[model samples]
Target: MDYSHVRGVDPAVADALEGEVDRQQNTLAMIASENHVSEAVMQAQGSALTNKYAEGYPGERYYAGCEFANDVELLAIDRAKELWGAEHVNVQPHSGTQANMGVYLAMLDPGDKILSLELSHGGHLSHGHPANFTGKTYDVEQYEVDPETGYIDYETLAEQAEAFDPDIVVSGYSAYPRAVDWERIQDVAESVDAYHLADIAHITGLVAAGVHPSPVGVADFVTGSTHKTIRAGRGGIIMCGEEHAKAIDNAVFPGAQGGPLMHNVAGKAVGFNEALQPEFTEYAERTVANARALADTFSQHGLEVVSGGTDNHLVLVDLRPSHPDTTGKDVEEALEEAGIVLNANTVPGETRSAFNPSGIRAGTPALTTRGFDEEATREVGELIVRIVDDYDDQETIDAVAEDVQALCDAHPLYD
Candidate 1:
């Protein structure tokens, strides 16, 4: 963790780097899309492979002296295949969004139709938000979760799919909590002669550990991040059957990006190896159990838990019903001051702007990695409720900060 070499060259940047380590060690990280990677993975990502410029897949490189690069990438691909049971996997995209872009490029031409969940309802921007390239390039339509139950209405989605007749049907979500029936969505896409792309970026680890349903063999294409719940390298991955493998490979290489980040690919190989152990299954199960405990604690306090609970690692809490005057941004800032860190998110049927939405999203991935169980997670949830109930009270914030520090000390990170 020492940055002495960096300090010798650039003290300012080194100070910032060291400060970030201190921050993560002190505060609770409840951001649903984040996790703590092992120092082994970090070392791999910071290795000499970062300088390599391998522009093609293994055994066919666009540059010389790429033997080590090929070895790392091949290991990543093999480990990913074993982890997810994917027939074919591409671990080259720089991010999850780029993986989605690769799929879009490989399958559809410009102005093709795309049907995905609406962003405020738990969909990602790459799916079809106006601010992103996908919205500008394609004709996009969106589906929604049932307003009353906070779950995807498959029948309604099928009806919309039949009517819209999109080129691709996008399943999976960023915030919606219940298990998705991938078969139902696949059937809907098949009925309309459309391809199905399942974006499981947030639940990649859960799916790999058999804690959540997977879309590898069921969907035409699957995309995920290596970081989130997977706790791997900071990168994206794409998986498909052999029939579409060549197209995906080409789209990701010459179509979207040039050179692969070999250092990150090495990190992926190391982390995937770590995930294959028996301990990872236990980790995944505990992550979901901790989330359920957090949601139950929220419900006992009269806070509205989206979908009434969670099946995975995150719980979405809508504050509109219980605390009508409090914005999500208000609670998020106050919690940060209390040494708890999560994000403001838009809930289904959102009545406010995205910047200051009505909901807060919390997850147990980082805390679980730090050895937290159900009891500790519930205690954290109670602390969150305290902040939500009296966010502006400085004395309450101070008390919660002390409690959060105690928790951090008990579950020491990077020790």
Candidate 2:
């Protein structure tokens, strides 16, 4: 993590980079979409490949001297195919949103209909939020989780799909904690003769480790970020059946992006190789177990754990039932001050604005990556509850900060 070269060039940027490394070492990162990549992956990402410009897929690159870039990209594609059992894989697209964009460009026209989960109820902005390009290009409708149970209402979704008659139906989520029924969603999509795009950006590693169900063979298109649950560097991937391979590739390259980030592709290669080992399975299982423990602790302490508990790496807590006066932002800031990091998230049937939502979302991926177990996660959950109970109490926050630093010390991150 030394920044000596950067310091020699520019002291200001070097200081910031060094400070960031120190911050990660000292705090707990509970953000659902974040994880610590292995040193191998990080080094690969920071490699000299960043200087290259390989404009196309492996062997068919438009530029000369792309031999090593071709090798790295091919290795990444092959590893991803093996990991997800997909017939075809595209390791281009700068991000998960771009991956989705690739799909829409390939299969949809402007003003085509899109059916997806509501953002507040566990959907992503790329699916169809008005602020994003997808919303501007497509005519969109949304489904939601059951108000009482806090779970996706499949029946309602089917009904919505029937009425909307969308050209595509999206199946994955960001904030929801329960397992998705991909086949059921596929059935609805099929009934309407619509394409199904499953975005597993948040659970790519979990699916690779067989901890979560995969949508590779079931959905018409599968898209994800290489980073979140996976230790891959920051990039996106798209997978589909062999029939649509050419279209996806062209859409990603000529349609959406120019040159692929070969350094990131190299990182994905290293991380995918790491994930292929048996230990990754244990890590995935422990991650889910830790989240369950966290959810149980929150519930036992009287917080309204959304959907009762979690089957994945995150737990969504609705603050209205237990602490109506407290906002998610309040808890979020207090926890950050206490060295615990998570996000203020909108919940199902949200009553507050998106900026100051009524729920908090926390996950165990980064913590689990740091060697945390169920017991350790439970302690972290207890500390979260303490902040939620008395966010304005500086003394309690100071005490929690001490305990959090001790936890960080016990489970050191980098060298």
- Count steric clashes of candidate 1: 0
- Report the C-alpha lDDT of model 2 over 295-342, residue by residue, as the tens digit: 999999999989999889899999999999999999999999999999
lDDT against the true structure, each candidate:
0.96, 0.95
Off by over 4 Å in 2: none
TM-scores of all candidate predictions against the true structure: 1.00, 0.99
Candidate 2 weakest ten by summed lDDT: 147-156
Model 2 has an lDDT value of: 0.95
Judging by lDDT against the true structure, name the best candidate: 1
How many clashing pairs per prediction, in order?
0, 0
Candidate 1 ranges beyond 4 A from true positions: none
